[model samples]
Target: MVNGPSTQMAFVEVDCLPTHRDLVVATLCRVPEIISIEVSARGRDLLLTVVTHDWTALSDLVLSRLQIDGILRHRTSLVTDIHLEASDWRLDALNRAQTLEVARIEVHSATVPSTVTPADTALIDLISHDGRIGFAELARLTQRNASTVRRQFTRLTACGIMKFRCEVSQESSRWPISCTWFCRVEPGHVAETVRILRGIPETRGCFSTTGESNFMFIGWARSVTDLLRIEKEVAQSQPTLRFLDSAVAFATPKRIGWFLDQSGCATGEVVVPTFSTPVSKKH
Candidate 1:
């Protein structure tokens, strides 16, 4: 059985020159530790979620690789937890097969109890490789019968251990820009802030993390004007929420562990790190 990742995860926010954007993305994508990269529509900034055994080493490596004249600045935050606000897993079987009209939202929060089982690991690995993999194929990969696989799948979903998502291309969907908003709210206001952000129609994912800016969300827009309108609406509605920073994804090479093709379908490459704690031995 494959042991899940036992180390900390990091979400690094980066800003660089638009001209060197491709070069920076190409370099970072080659690093195995980087699980996914979301580039802004203007190609001036990026958000990288990296899984590694050592946070310090990973941060240093990122700085070294991206430190250039075009590189304006960067910051790395240790992700304490990840919360899935919405995705295909939250939908019924029929909805899971339908195309997504918006971006999926995942929030990073403080550490929580580890929820990993052999079956959960198997399901995640298989689905990460193929988001739309059917039950029969999943059974074949996990060495279980169809019935057992289906039962485990249901259990995993119920327990919130993992979820599957079907992403559509921005061009096809007519939402050409994807933006992630990092907001710092009063300690007691975090939950309310998240709720407000999630309620927005543009919100694809909403997350709470460990840092000054504890709330984050990904929202979609058709253009810069539309994005500004969304932000304006949020500001007027939620005056208590302080906006920290935002990054627009021009290209997403990988999202939620699936290596994406130009059209945003899974490309058979899964970089998702498993999280499982070792079982204690009895005396």
Candidate 2:
């Protein structure tokens, strides 16, 4: 059995200085098992998903280190996860899912049957880490041939089931990091508006929903003013949309397509450190 990361996801309640939230997240990224972590609205809480040898060890780490951060207030719930092990067949099936049936727009439906295998999934997970991992590294990790891995990568990307991009980490620039603005768009005109939204290079991710915000999207802005320009462009492009609310995330504890959690299991890369206590001081 792979026995890798087959545990449940968790939502941890946390409170901290609005100024220090990002710092806290950057710190938590050290946890080895956590696949993803993100900040939420209202007080302060971080959504975390991690793998465990046993769920109990996972719980102790959460309470002992994360909750005691002095800067954080921690409340955790291990969400029920019925999904089984990750498989290439499952992913290929998802990609093969019909267009109208596909839940997200980024997932364009396919006509051909899948050619992906378990080795391919493993390889993609590897290169996805640095966003620039070479084929030889992936083959070594998954024990597959280099040429085979390259073919799988091309097919997977060509199938739209995976993606990779140059990371714009804060270390690269002092300018404000980019963020996406999710909107509670009124019903109707959903499809029409998405087309307009994608026209902009700043746009990175987009999806429709049935919640108060029916459509969600991410875009990059160099500054507050640039952010507004993107918004204005959105307004002008989709005049029919009756916008309800918008959330401008100054800092993202998590990215839109971050399959990797705090830990780097998605890529079988580095293990992100973790604290098993509250994240911030709850005032």
Candidate 3:
């Protein structure tokens, strides 16, 4: 373990009320130090690789802001940090998280394949700590074929169940991808708030977790200032929400999707079926 105020990416687990799920995720999106926000089976949550010195802040975020609306229970764990991203560990962890439950795979298991298992849990910790890896690096991490990695990624995203996009590093790129930040809302209005948020074209994912914040939200913006303006507008628009604090991210450390699991990681463990596209290619 990296001693002192610094951390080595530990998985944080939060048990949230199903209704408050979306609100929790939407709130965490803007936190600057948070590396990534994805959904999974450990229950709906925003798994973040918090900066080593900033881990305490994460606790405050979950408690003060994330403890409202529909949230019921909150738990935290220190699963091993994998030093990778969600997309990179998708297939490998899926096989491992599942293996913990049974001696063999069965067709009738009720669990969705997308939730992060203990095996992937370790990878999640790593991505939280280091979300800046590539396919070649990930291939080496799991010792898998590059073709297999590519195929799994394409299949997962094409199915519309999950996806991973290139995120430019902070200040390195003139134009960064669109995004959002959040503040906690009163526990009663989470559902209403989410309905409004999802109505926006840019909002991508949301979740509820432990700490001062009760929610985390992420979305695309045309520019940095554009995202800031939107966050401000949201505060004014939702009076019942009781906004507490917020942050805006320039880069992420890790994330997960269908190639790794399902839409749950991005959207609070909501079951999303595989994407079905009309065939346009010649047979």
Candidate 4:
């Protein structure tokens, strides 16, 4: 089991030839640490969510096993905080209010059980494919009654084991220019810098990670001009922040365990592989 709330997480971007996509996914899914995998719409890269008790071993595994010849490049960022934008719900007012309401929930120390029951696993498998599935549908899929399934769903959400969010596609969103920013901030200013980034309307997600450039954020733009403008505004507003690099995301094939189709809709299919053996500690 994970060491409770202190479990460390990392987001990795893997760039590879299109031909190696499935191979890459298959290889990564076999690794016990990877929790989620996403493919870009363009199909050239993948995003992975990894959980580990030891960052050093996890880094070694990623660098050795995941960086095959066909793989062009890969970048890993440690996640300190994650902010999800609810663009699909179109409930900006409600979302903003709920965001504040949930502010009391600690970010860095949220505990996710390292082990789960079969029922819990089934529920997670079903919901990951379709976060909006009706209770009746979930009951049928999980071989449980509607009431039981509903209770399980509620419990999972309440415990931070699961979350339901709107996934918007670049082609459909008003601000379609999606990019990830790798940033460096003054050691003392990391918290303030992340706060400012989260407050930006275009910021879809932001995180603090371990590395030379210790921060990363995802932002959207309506056009190249808008993207540049946003970048300039952020730079001006937070003088302590420095951009190390940025990468444009052309696609997101899988998110939070759901496999996405060409139109960027969740296919209600789970592609992330599971391991029968418990995760072993390298340290």
lDDT of each: 0.65, 0.51, 0.44, 0.65
TM-score of each: 0.69, 0.51, 0.35, 0.70
Across 66-119, the per-residue lDDT of candidate 4 in tens digits comes to 767568888777776544433212325457768777566633334456555668
Residue 243 of model 3: what lDDT? 48
Give the alpha carbon lDDT tens digit for every residue of 1-283 in model 2: 1122333344444667677766777666666555546555433445454544446767676766575443556655454422221221111223445734644544343433233345544654465455577889877878878898887766665554454333344323333434434466555676667668656756655655434445556554566678778888888988766555444443444432343333322433344222111123337
Query: How does candidate 1 fare on TM-score?
Result: 0.69
lDDT minimum window of 10 residues, candidate 2? 82-91
Ranking by TM-score: 4, 1, 2, 3
Cα displacement (Å) at residue 276, model 4: 13
Question: Lowest-lDDT window of 10 residues in candidate 4?
Answer: 82-91
Number of clashing residue pairs in every model? 10, 37, 51, 4
- Where does candidate 4 stray beyond 4 Å? 1-7, 13-69, 72-75, 80-115, 261-269, 272-283
- Per-prediction CA RMSD (Å): 6.5, 11.8, 17.7, 5.9
Q: Measured by TM-score, how close is model 2 to the native structure?
A: 0.51
Residue pairs with colliding backbones in model 1 are: 39-249, 39-250, 40-248, 40-250, 41-250, 81-109, 105-204, 105-205, 107-207, 108-208
Worst 10 residues of 3 by lDDT: 270-279
Q: Could you tell me the C-alpha RMSD of candidate 4 in Å?
A: 5.9
